[model samples]
Target: MAVMTETEPPPPPPIRGRTLYRLRVLRHDPTALLGLVLVVVLAYLVVAPLVAVLSDAFRLQYGDEAHAGQAPGEWTGYYLWRVFRSPVSRLLFWEPLLNTLVVAAGTTLFALVLGGGMAWLVTRTDVPGRRWLAGALVVPYMLPSWTFSLAWLSLFKNERAGGQVGFLEAQGVRTPDWLAYGALPIIVTLGLHYYPFVLLLVGNALRRIDAQLEDSARILGAPRRTVVRRIVVPLMLPALSSAVLLVIGRVLGTFGTPYVLGLPADYRVLSTGLFQSIRDRSTGVASVLATVIVIIGVLVVFMDMRLMREHRRFVTVGGKGAMDRLGRLRRLRRPAFALALLVFVVSVLVPVLTLLLSTITRTPLDLSTFTLDYWLAERLPGAVGFPHGVLRGHELWEAAWNSLRVVGLASVVCAVAGLLVGYVVVRGTAPRVAGFLRQVSFLPYLVPGIAFAAASLSLFAVARGPVPALYGTTFLLILVMAVTHLPYSSRSGIAAMTQLGREPEEAAQVAGASWWQRMRRIIFPIQKGALVTGIVLPFVSGLKELSIVVMLATTGTQLLTTLSIGLVDYGYTQLANAVVLMIALLSFTMTTLTQRLTRTSLASGIGG
Candidate 1:
């Protein structure tokens, strides 16, 4: 009997049994399954491309074989040496790096001064038309950043580029190089575009401050400047720092403004330098620059988070009955109003009108040279490639349609995927998987659009494993845009889902409803408004998105933005201005409609 007992032991559990058990568990718990799927997809879509970019920076690229004496795809340190240690590194990296730092610092300072001051006027002081100014000040943000640059050139361009002089130059007023095309114009234009960040963040912060704090300081015989320094500034440091980081981050990666204004003067920042490398097929060099840009962006984001945490340690405690009255301007009210109006004119109305004027007149602001030819004519001299008026041409319509189709589809994709991501993040039983999914989904927000595009071009441009090469395809554009803009929708989704209880989905599950059925019939119906907001935000953003598509779009998939920039490159300024106006018109109309529907303008945060 003892010998028989040793003859047989329990059979080992089959591998198939374990796998089937996991499948069954996954089937029952859709959130866990979804989280797993999302982690994989986001890793491939978001993380893989970044890895590819980083890898490329250390590898020998195709055209660098001769220079590096290594085969393409082999690991090499030549790119690093070329970018940071070579003789031409000054032009290739150092100068651009220095220029980027200067521009970022200058733009941050300018935006903070302008935006923080305006925010104080609107939120703290009794400024005239505060409501209207609050809304109007953010208009430049909605327009593409380069819209200001184009308008700047229309008004201030010198003979630097040689083809077409600006309005001042046309009038025999030769604009200076510094004011026309270098860091000054770039800084000012980008500042005007980004100041809204400060307005929204600082304005909201200003509102949250108890007016009694300032009044208390003033009543204690503290001078106005002393009161501001001791009380108001300390309370608002978090927001000011946030705005500074936001402005700096944007300036770091913005391409259109710098490219349009900088190329003529050989003024290159990291963005334009990366662009030049990409255009010249210097993939290794572009990868190095892009990596540097991305690292800077990540640092900025980390700094923002750390600063917010540090600032919280010195929180201002306000009483329940805190008075929030607007500061009386007395006799300065009218002048303050005029100053805000003048800013609006310079930032919003002037750029828009300048572009409109350019489109109408053969020369800017010249009424006698006015002609409808730019918009309505079928043919005009010197309009070489784009022969017809923008309104009359199929090119404009086609590009508009492409923008709508690609961006529209991408927005819908983002909304759905974002909701799924939220579901997984909020309900998944696996904490690790859920946390990974959440973090991965938000990674694209840290990577700049241009750098992301370059990464996408590097990773997806060629076939990998079973995936086919995706370079120059509309699908690639849609994919890149959806990933780049996912943060807006994902944040919207998470916020909406956080307020919703799991009871509805649970009840549906008890009724034998499947996961997809519950999502479609219960979750989606309940979160329709959030979903719409998600779609509208991304759609509006993508409509004006230039940096992402500029690198990904092909001739067949030209968006309104690319088409406009192309005209600019071709020396067709009026034609380009016409397209820029169309983009602004569409963007403004959509934002206005959204406001009408939701009782919430995009700038409502600042206004409140």
Candidate 2:
């Protein structure tokens, strides 16, 4: 036996050719095959559309007539040259680019200062009402981004914008034009909306940090400042980087805030620029803008990845219950906690309350002239015009109905695909396939919503393969929304399935249960909570979404959010406000329901 082992078993039967070798490897690990299928399918669905946009950017098109001195399908640098070097490029590209950078940078700075300060106060000090503040902080993020923009406009729109007087004017305050629109309002609105991201990320890290490190430094005769600067700050860098990256990524791609604010002042950020280019039939220029945005996105994502990798090396695990407690500021604690509470109230509650108030008001800024007519009045005469009362009108009801139908369809598609991808990634044995699937599934998260919509428009405006023309159909909106939101639901599914161990499935299999039977009886039951969350979140997101569907939607297929955009375009601020409020309510209710469902499931899982 020893001699036979030394002979190396005759070279293991001379390993087979490439195809057979792949088959053998797959036979040993079926998970890889599943992952490969997922990756290829997702690439076609997600990556192919992006490629189409890139290809579109280099092609020249003429306006129906004689080709205009340029070949129809010829590759040209006209778009790039015009966008980057032409005289109008400053107005079209550079100014907006600078504005985008300024807004993103300012938003990041404000969010970090506000969120980090609050996180430190709550996690380090014994702040009063920390629990309430923590809960309230995230509410702004849950609301639609445009909700804040519209609320701000309602509270501050001056005479310059041609809208009715705002709340400030009603209160004997002359609001400045700068405050009502442009980069200032956008920065403030976006900052307030996204600060919660920083809070959650930084606060969680703060909570998990071991207290002993700070204490050890203190015991070594280090001062509080020294300990903070040398010990705490170093540890917090990774979290800060992550928060900044996330906030920047979000702000860069944001369309609603910029659209609501920027369009009024001709403040064209990349997203708005792309939207304008597309609307004006400048597809080549729009594609270039989309590419630019995608490049920025990819760069930011790379930075985030690098930071996360670096964070892994700094991990500290130790004994239980090691948390540092900062000495209270005593009398200052109440004031500090109150200020934090005030910020939450102003950012989350006040804006939402203002929206509710504006919805009931007959005129945009006249708070005293309250009326349920906006909510109840059905089909006012055309003379009422722009903000005409159509609350209970057939069109309004139809848009709402369409919104529910599209969002419901999208949610189902996303949930099912996300769960399948998640299951394959978590339980499958193929490392190569799993890694590929995971990366491609997350590609949409790196893409701006407007860019994605533009890509979809470019791809599906004409038929390809089994998929027919989807340009004006409700199905296009559903597909775009579903794919754009896949990352969230897929990530949620992965996390949920990972938490659920394999023992149940293994036991089912041992009892002679088939794969589908095991999935139905054992796996699905355990993961139902996550599945609901996955579905509900996308439903809510799709309900309030503006950027992704703005390009693809037509009059016949308009969702409520898109309808709100149309109302805005027609200068119907009050009616737009009403529509926005309805969308916000729907989103808020869905989010609350999902959170409750998630919590109940988590609790049940823990108890069982």
Candidate 3:
């Protein structure tokens, strides 16, 4: 009362909308505005398609007149019931679901064990040939998943599958049915191919941890095993969880591995089932299946987020510290080295060698029947029933050209957009807009590639406003691949920017340089290595990506991966193997060149 008597009646509290209006006026930030725009655009892109797919699932299609007993587009649980409760559900849903779970679980266990062990040996132990092992470990992940599947099939395909005799049979080994095509081979091949993801993630974490913490534990009388169990394992949980989630998400949505290995035995997982449904013109049921896959993907992502949030409690020492050199195994060193070498050979070298051998073989399993006919002949006598040799195939050349164009475009777009998004998020003062952009950019990472492809097809099939139908276009493929890979490049950008402090920019500003001048002359020059990494990693990934393009690509837009899949469908294994090898070689060369360029630039800059 006394204060009110002296003061002009307290200024009226701002109105709700007025407060927001004032806030916007005060935050005249270009980055924030750009981030808001990006977030909204991404959300619309991701969500609208999903909405369409869900709607399509519920509504009757033009050809659904056969299901006349059910009301068209009316609220009905018919699709779900038919897939989940009917007698046929056992074959369509339940059996495949069980098989999928088993394969997924087995793959996870194998990858974790193999990748984790190798990561530890390379990062923590005084292991011999550590550098060689480290580089070799990443090769499997770089190659296409189906490359491994084809290799496995080339070596293991039995008479049961109607293929030319496999390597085992050629050696007079009666390969068991399980080894040829089914759950067992599928799990093993996929696990070996995907384990490198775990190795990269976990090994990076292990390398970054301070050695002083373990030394301190030892000095406190903690035994090596105890210390490892209590300290190392706890510290690694975040990275481990990240790897696990990634593998699970990848395996769950994978179409190539199962198709190559499982389809021969009539083994069907959700992805295979969905593909069949679409192929059979059962669009409603396929959409429903895609929706289910999306739900599962969302749930896994939620769990991953929860694990990351709780990871902070496991922190050990934080400051810069030395890496401990584990004691040499001495007598065990040779055996350990041999074991690691053997694993590398089995996992990477053998499969690739097998593929190369198969590409030149006249027939699948008859090495004695070897021929350059598949590669050098203008036509393979039409016995293999293909129009041209692998070398001269017009279709193969066209697919390769298409792959390069699409992947190259996608990489450029993703890199630029990701860098912009990263700058906005890390530099902007508007927390809400920044956070929204960052999270939305990451949304595509959490969705299964197949499901995302399906959703994109639904969204772009029809025109919305000025955006015309992008269906069956290379532009559409480029857009989807770019958006799908945005998360990785965005992360690269954020890391790059964070490592590059604002002091240099501030110095330029103080000296009267404009923002554009500072960015062009100073910031970009220093950050070019990271920029290249951001661009090239996505390029490599997009080049090999299969699932994201599977549903969207038509004959006009067929990418190399899709072409390989088509060849498999047509039962042209040798030609398909040749294409797969070409794709793998291209990806490997690009990745190696990019990394070397980045490192050389960084080294030269540091020296200067």
Candidate 4:
């Protein structure tokens, strides 16, 4: 009775002002506000450009009113009819569609075979120099996809496209159309560039595979091949599926590879067809084709979703005494080692050497002739359009500087925003908002870069809502690049954040720390590696980007990619090769520096 009389009421709930309440809510459950903001912003960025593209499909577009026989801005089915039912439908859509499927399929097959085999050899076998091969194989990925095509053309391109004959053709060996300009070259070039995607994904999975499972199967008298066919193959399906999807998506929209390789043979895929339509001022046709490509890309992604759902029932991540078991190559060891070495030489070494030789030679592939003009001459005696050497003036340096500035700003902002978006998606209280933010962030990856560029140009060329007109501005370039490359940073952020425990933040909260304080002191320090990864991947990729920037760059805003492409357009082959080499060198240098600074790796950072 005395205790009851003396007992005070339960402590009152803490009183908070509106600002403090808001801050507390943000610190505790940011989903309702911060997550919503990210979702809305990301959705707008991804969906607006798409809407801009699709809207052009239904309405009579500018410069197409005459062709559509309708007033501009009027809604009509003319574009749909022309693409699906008109007389040239087969030529305009069907053939290219068929060709697109063929290229995508071929490229996927090539990448899977080469990449999968290399992954096994490097990760699951005691191959000689496994460390070197592993690093060497990934080098090709750092270079632009078009670099392979350019190198291929330098060695295999005949006189079909005019200008100078390729090395072989110059040596009086006539390269057939099939080998030099069409599907074969396109497939090979793309495969060389994209196989690293497979290697990284599959090898990461392979390294994590449990040796106990295979050992048990072997002890049960299961043959080696049978164990692999059953246990290994099933375990690898998820990685294989992802690698296939990535390759297909890239092949579907890759402009430079197909454009460089397919032009001479009239081998047009959907991407090249889209480019042709836009170049020809057929905006209606371009929209129709672009929409179809996006549809295909979506279907591929959906199929992957279904596969992932099915794969979840089978777990491979954890098991007692699980460890990587390298296969005993035994008699096949050296042959396997040789095979891996050959791939490294062909995929990484050959193309780079070819580009170097091209840059030094007035007559490429001719060992007897060499000139330093492309690298350092003040003037060229017989040069036509670009009458000066590549290093003759500030043009090259200016382009490099612009590239560094634009890409640097974009990557830095992208990395920071990615971290915030990741925080919201993972730790926020709003499930719906989190999910939307997560998906929208990855949306740009499936969309073709050129189609994305077209959409951005259409949408941002004029002011809308809070954003002013961004066309013709360097900031626009930075924004386009950032959005286009958001998948890298966001994915990195989300992966890193998922592994981080909330205990640190909760501890900070218990200590009366604010949200920003927690993020700065705990989250940022732990995720420094991932932040560097996000920044570096985008910077490396952005340095070599051609398609997205081609449509967006204005006069006097030449980036390195645009500079190289300009030289190519003017038939400055040697100079173009020099610029390409410079791009590769810059990419390699930055990658190396970043690794030293952060002590991370391409394989680990990329996969994990």
**Top TM-score hit:** 1
The candidate scoring highest on lDDT is: 1
Q: Which whole-number lDDT from 0 to 100 does residue 308 have in model 1? A: 84
Clashing pairs for model 2 are none
Supply the global lDDT for candidate 2. 0.81
**Cα error, candidate 3, residue 484 (Å):** 0.3
Which candidate model has the greater TM-score, 2 or 3? 2
lDDT values for all models = 0.88, 0.81, 0.80, 0.83
465-486 in candidate 4: lDDT tens per residue?
A: 8899988899989988999889
lDDT of 1 by residue, 450-499 (tens): 99999999999889999899997889988888998888888888888889
Which ranges in model 3 have alpha carbons more than 4 Å from their true place? 1-33, 65-75, 170-172, 208-232, 318-322, 365-367, 383-385, 427-431, 464-466, 495-527, 600-608
How many pairs collide in each candidate, listed in order?
A: 0, 0, 0, 0
- Once model 4 is optimally superposed onto the true structure by TM-score, how far is the C-alpha of residue 55 displaced, in angstroms? 1.0
Clashes of 4: 0
